[model samples]
Target chain A: MKILVGIKRVVDYNVRVRVLPDGSGVDIDGVKMSINPFDEIALEEALRIKEAGKAAEVIVISCGTDECQQQLRTALAMGADRAIQVKTGSALQPLSTAQALLRVIEREQPGLVILGKQAIDDDNSQTGQMLAALWNRPQATFASKLVFEGEKLTVTREVDAGLETIEVDLPAVVTVDLRLNEPRFVKLPDIMKAKRKPLDVIPLEELGASLASNLDITRYAAPPLRQKGIRVENAAQLVQELKNRGLL
Target chain B: MSKILIVAEHDGHTLNLSTAKCVSCAKAIGGDIDIAVLGQGHDAVGAQAAALAGVSRVLMISAAHLAHPLAANWAPEVLQLAANYTHVIGPSTTMGKDLMPRVAALVGVNQFSDVMEVLSPLSFRRPIYAGNAIIDVKAAEGQKIVMTVRTASWPATGSGGNAVVEQRTAQGTAAGHSRYLALNSAGSERPDLQGASKVVSGGRALGSAEGFALIYRLADKLGAGVGASRAAVDAGYVPSDMQVGQTGKIIAPDLYLAFGISGAIQHITGIKDSRTIVAVNKDAEAPIFEIADIGLVGDLFTVIPEIEALLG
Candidate 1:
């Protein structure tokens, strides 16, 4: 009856990212920020469930700096009843994010958890499963379709060859894929109403969880530029070059 | 003393191409390759994994309950299996995307997903900026190294004769947050886009979803899987499942035939590994021609029909 959705703040996909000159990180200046694209799908799925009367309550939760409150409000404006923000100045890896979400899970005890399959920034699609493991729950990741029947949840997953569907008991984690549904836009009236809704801000340390990264990023460097190609005059010359490169 | 764990992601019986590719990556990393198969009647899956070249053992976690892969359930077993293995690897499929990071978290490490090249046992290369740029990263901590392979670039191991299977128990987790309902397979005999050696893709320049469907016709003739650039997918010309790019699915088919696609860096990164790349773009200066083995400076509507007629 209780549904929880995980949202993340990421650099807007439209912006062209530039690597820092020092090769330490991406340049964050003047870049537009928004909720992760896939997370939007996750929030939309939860909203639909609530609209269908399948969920008694829907809560949007996010872990980021104070800036992430904007993303939480976006979710709430779309239809989430309330929002929970786990504030942290530093960026947390998927592992630490999962740990923090587990602390929230313990408190909220939601029967269903939905999250984006992967965040476009780090692209590490691990948090949902990690939280599921820590909570001893069953998880259906990358769901194209999800339906609840009795105490069972049926989920269709996108696999390499094709699609696959499975049913697991309730209290499971499901990650949303892009095809799940088109998220509804927040009208002006809903946005104004969401402003009046309750939004709670909690510090990560207050949750008694360590946001330390278990893995060290010793160094990050851009990949070498691809080799320049020889100018060709015709198909014959292309064939000659292919032969030279041993591609033929 | 550290064993290499290769996670098998399949429907249940047949082995997927990415599994074989991961085995090849595992061999390059140098370890006693062990397979972990989860599903009902994993006997065939275990045998298939064991038969692959360089596999030493196959760990079968057969359970009626595991007929489907639940990352929540699977991660805990991997955590337990980590006690026996030194390293773990899988293909960068949606399932791996969901499962690998959890295993890494359970073992208390940050997992590197969608790695394209293994520079060393500890160093790796992955695409960032939506595959517009590559980033080399080094994992300096954690006793176990966990990462997912980018599929097409890695060579798959040849079929082997037999393998040893050891059945293990699944950790029953009470938190059933999600469940498997039903499957609607794409139902194509052609190889999957991610694992195919030859890929034929279409773009929005073809004009409509029906135009994109031509890819299937060509792919069927060429015995290749259908692929599409993000432009085609985002334009609603094709299903998101058919997208081939950094934000979509990355592939390295042997022969890539791209029709009507201008080579965006993200789109190019997906097919850059193809041994022979042919691009048919009306725009002669399209970036795709930069890396293409064959460039047809003509309209795809004109060139594709000609190519299809030639093949016929």
Candidate 2:
């Protein structure tokens, strides 16, 4: 069995974001970027599954520009056999990205595909399910627990309502949640070796993937600042203010 | 004037909390909200949706097969419904996350998922870095707009007024690729974390999974649901089912009680909207105190049992 883990390079989670001077997008002049935290969880899970002797090879795939090679290399250093980079300077929208992935899935026919439930930058949790829909495969998204027995994969999904366990056959897509596995740090020795590992670069055109842009942004703005709240000195003052404000 | 469609998500009976919340959001955007309820015996569902404070009409598509929400099966209906409506709105649940993108792509517009607030008919506010920052963007160049509303900020209204129901058939059950194999529900017998009015959350200080039982007992006594800080869940002290943090579930309960939670910024973002917050942690400097309405600087092990015994 083969495992394909998807990764993305995104702005560091801790950095506070600023709108660009152009009012068109986020200001990225000097911001640091790292592999999305969730995507790291996905790669970590793939490595663990392989370490447990459940799979033969682990392949890390990412769709971004030259900078994203660093993310793929990070995955490779963490024990992936190889990586595929679909070089597109600008980011591909979810659907087109799914199309590009489907092309790769068709070519490699990996037994399983794992990805983070959502990207932190876009906060769009649609890609995994969208890719599953495109591939016509069963998806166990927001998977917190994954137990593989024979040909069946039982996964526990973390939902707003609580946890839901579902079982799916192989050749399925599963999106990793935070609890799936704690990601391991890349050893310095492995990082050095990863510099020489097989890193294949493919273009969207080679996969015959459509790069159509769907949504257009007119402008970017900040949310309205919340009004300064008045602090009451005591419970009586609080109740009095509540009554005065007609909220009592 | 373009007709705006709101997809009604229900449990085959009462509407999902976020659906009503989305309705309020849609109304804020200035639209004639037409609700689409697809499932068996949906007349009542449609009527109930129409009764929401801002709903104008109900478009009912009732069928036994449509009862289970399969995104593969519902996208085409959403697409067909989109043909008649100018904008589409739904709660950003698993179903909407699965269904909306396909519906948007079918019409060549990218759907916006996880919108926090609508600034205008065309612009919206959404979190960019896992609740760390907010970005407001304006959608351009399409008559059709689709967005999913984050569930926490909006309150559910059961306000039912008379609304006209328009019967329509879906473009046949969307059958092609995916198949529903099996579903195993987590029978927690507790209100969903996102919808619970009161949440009793434990942190890593709880020590182990056995420790969570104490928190659960207190939650049970208060008729509240159990939640966990990310550290606790990561430490395997509690099931992922109870995780409440930025990467996990976002909740806005009426009263939130944090037991032993040290309170990371990520965790605070999840429950900051609770009306009244109570924090009980031995660590006096825990960040949970910043937003807490009441702070008890004490050990949770001693405080929780006492609270439970008192409530009992």
Candidate 3:
């Protein structure tokens, strides 16, 4: 069995992303870019499944420009057997990205596909589910725990109401949540080895993936800012303030 | 003029407040709104949905597999009904975030999340980067707009009107491969964190699971929903259902009180929409103070008691 892990190159989670003053989009000028935090969790889970002998090979794939190969190398360093980079502009949305991955899925035919529930950048938690819809396969999303028994796979999903469990068959998509596992830190030795690993770059158009850019973003602006507040001296002052505001 | 179909969320008994919030968004878009309640034996839920002010009608869709809110089964049913509506929308809750995209894909269109403001039927503004920035998006002309409403940013439509309720059988069947096991959740008597007007959340500083008793006591007194930072949930101090963060519940309450939370950006994303924020962290320089409407550099343990006494 093979596990294809889908990852994305996104703005580092720690960096406070700023909107471009020109209203084009976010400013990524000289900003640190890395594998999305959730994508790393997905990769880590795929690696563990392979380490546990449930799978044979772990192939990490990313959809973006050549610059994304840098993150692919990072995934390779983190223990992916190889990497595939679908060449495309950086403006790809979740639907198109899912289509590109499906193209790769046709080429790889992995038994299981794992992706982060959402990209921290776009915050669109749609790809995994969209991919399953396009592939006509079962999707177990927001998975925190995954247990595979031969052809059957059980997933524990984290939901707003509470935790729910569901079982999906193989050749399915599983979007992981936070509690799945903590990603391991890439070591210096692994970085050197990753440089020697195979990395393939394919143009998205060659794979016959359609770019669905239907949502036209017209402007970018900051969210409403809160007015500077006063500091209360003590619990008594806080209580009085709450009363004045009628929040009490 | 637009015809909007709302995919209602429910527990087979009562309508989730999020459905009413979607009604608010659809009303803003200036449309004839009909809610589709897909579940098993959901007549009560159908009646509740039909009473919302802007709802024109409620469609009760029933099948044995519709009892669980699984996207695989529900999306196909929604797709079948999508022909009559120009826009199909749902709440941006876990269920919505999970289900809407599948429907959008099946319909061969792009889906929008967190539709904060409706500029026109096809254009709207939504938040990105964890609420740090907003984007104005416009769907292509003549394309069906499939979206999820940012329930936090919208007020629930009042329940005043009485609309007709109709029953229909689901054309979609359950997936052969996917089956729901059992859900493991401890039912809480407290108000749901997402819909509560006032939210009181604790952080890792609560120290232990037993220490959350203090937070529960305070929330009980104030009649607020209880939430926790991801740290507290990760530490097992509370269940993930009580978590409030970028990955958890994005809540907008009239009054939000963060006790001992250091205000990581992830945690701040969940509460940035709050009307008024109050912070009680011992650390004076906690990042939460930057956005807090009231900041008190004191121990939450001691301050909570004093505030409780004052309320008494």
Instruction: Please give, for residues B1-312, the per-residue lDDT of candidate 1 as tens digits.
Output: 447898998877789888988988877777688888878876877888878877777888866556777676677777778788778887888778777877887787777777777777777777666654557767764467888887866888898546677877777552245455566666767787777666889987989988776778878877888888878887888767788876578777667878889988778767777767877788889988888767777777766666566555
Better of 2 and 3 by lDDT: 3
- Comparing only chain A of model 2 with the true chain A, what is the TM-score? 0.94
Superposition TM-score, candidate 1 onto the true structure: 0.88
User: What is the alpha-carbon lDDT for the whole of candidate 2?
Assistant: 0.77
- Model 3 bad stretches (over 4 Å): none
Candidate 2 structure quality by residue, lDDT tens digits, A1-248: 99998998888877767766666777777788888888899988888889999999999999988889988898899899999999887678787888889899998999999999888787877777677767867677888888898877888777655566666778888888877778999999999999999999998788876755455555566434323334334334433443464433
* CAPRI grade, predicted model 3: high
Sort every candidate by lDDT, greatest first: 3, 1, 2
B1-312 per-residue lDDT for model 3 (tens digits) = 899999999888889999999999999999799999999888999989989997788988989888888888888899999999999999999899989999999998889998999999999998888888899999988899999999888999999979889998888788787888888876888888988989999999999999999999999999999999999999999999899989999999999999999999999989988999999999999999999999999999899999899889
Q: Interface RMSD (Å), each candidate? A: 3.4, 4.9, 1.1
Q: Lowest summed-lDDT stretch of 10 residues in model 1 chain B?
A: B172-181
RMSD of each: 3.4, 4.2, 1.0
Q: Which pairs clash in model 3?
A: none
Candidate 2, TM-score vs. the true structure? 0.85
